[model samples]
Target: MRYRDENKVLAIREAAIDMVASDGLENFGINRLAKAAGVSPATIYIYYKDKEDLLTSISIEEGVKMTRATLKGFDPNMSFKEGLWVQWQNRAAFSLDNHKSAEFFEQLRNSTYKDKMLETINDEFRKNMGNFVENAIERGEIERMPLEVYWSVAFAPLYSLIRFHNEGKSLGGRKFKFSEKIMKETFDCVLKGLTK
Candidate 1:
């Protein structure tokens, strides 16, 4: 085999993300991935154990980035609303600027491998998020509920808007855009409903 090249691994990852996003997960295969990456199937084996391993790698790498981006400016001492606003902004910007990573994430989150990917996410990032949520509940800033519910309430809308904006789609003939006004309104509405 030729000397190992890190660029080949990165190309494989990029191709995997694009392929997974464009085609359903079930349709993805080593031959197609190799062709897309311009690398041989044997080379992929050198870098990854199998398709599952490569997919898991993508999940962990992108998951950490998205998690770190989501937690940018997160402060347990700050009001829950302030933290949420910061989260919204970070996530929106990350998704808009890194569409491939964002799409890879969205696809993975909705795939059968989601549970396994979640299990492998960075523990430090998970703990920080948990601490923020627990602190909010203890402070009586939000009602007691599963962390997933709280997150869905806080971010699902923002994700929808970002998706529309990325696709340049219009809602009733008006192009979708993310703005401070939209962010503030979303934060207010979602936070108010969660508050005690």
Candidate 2:
């Protein structure tokens, strides 16, 4: 039995993410991915069974990575403001540093694979996030609201800013650059709206 090459695997993964992000999933295929990764289609088969398997596997791996990055140093028991600040810092750092992976996930979330991907997300991530929201509501640190509303208010602005940063321009063709100051100011507004 031949052993799989880690370098090739990494190359395939990166190429797959870039392809999917740039060309959309409809245009992704093993042949195209093999060419992009400089590997043969047989090599991809060594690791993944088929297109669905490959896409799902990569999405699961990326989701775990994102979960870990988002949850670093976070605790459900912390005050809502403190916990959310940590989340903001971690998420902003991860999304900025891994913009392609972030974009891939954004696309995945809207695709037919979304349900399957969500089913595979880390259990700890779900638990901690759920507990954090519950604790916040119980402690009166944040208003009781639907999950959709909470996510929209808590994270939509951060994502919008990240999108602007990635594009290098914002509204009115203004040059855009990401800064901690901007993130903090945006977080403050989100925090105030979330809390009483």
Candidate 3:
């Protein structure tokens, strides 16, 4: 087996992220990424054979980073409501602060066909959050349903809100105004739907 060059791979990844942020991923290309990273185009080919390979790699990296960030500082002992609210707020805060990352993730979600490699990369995130959902159900705090359903309830709405904000949607007349109160309310609503 060949030893993967970590520094070269990292450079290409970083350059790809920058390109995606500045211009949408559609505008990103291997030649442009190589130029941005100060490496030969062959270097990019060495790391990733094509644009799809690079994009899959980028999606996986961003997914892992966002998953860790979202689950950061979560306390296992907190009440289900409190814990869920904290999770919601954490994700919302990350989305607002890192719009580019959020957009990139949303793009991946909207893709028609799911790549196996990308799906494997997203599994850790599902597993982590599913643990929390399973625990809550085991304690009779929430209804016993498929973890995917619970995840959709918890996260899809938040993702939609982030997309709305990114598109410059006006939230005027909204009582929560995208504050803690809003996060709490949204979490509570999701909990109500999930709970018995």
Q: Report the C-alpha lDDT of model 3 over 94-162, residue by residue, as the tens digit.
A: 888877766566555655314633664566566766677667778888777665776698778777666
**Local lDDT at 138 for model 3:** 80
lDDT of 1 by residue, 73-134 (tens): 87766778777778788878888888887777677888888986787667877787778788
> For model 1, what is the error of residue 142's alpha carbon versus the real structure, in angstroms, after optimal superposition?
2.7
lDDT of 1: 0.81
lDDT of 2 by residue, 68-123 (tens): 89999999999998999999999999999999998888778889989877876778
Per-candidate local distance difference test: 0.81, 0.92, 0.71
Q: Which stretches of candidate 1 lie over 4 Å from their true place?
A: 146-149, 170-174
Ranking the candidates on lDDT from highest down gives 2, 1, 3
TM-score, candidate number 2:
0.96
**Residue ranges of candidate 2 with Cα displaced over 4 Å:** none
lDDT of 3: 0.71
Per-candidate TM-score against the hidden true structure: 0.84, 0.96, 0.69
Per-residue lDDT value at 103 in model 3? 59
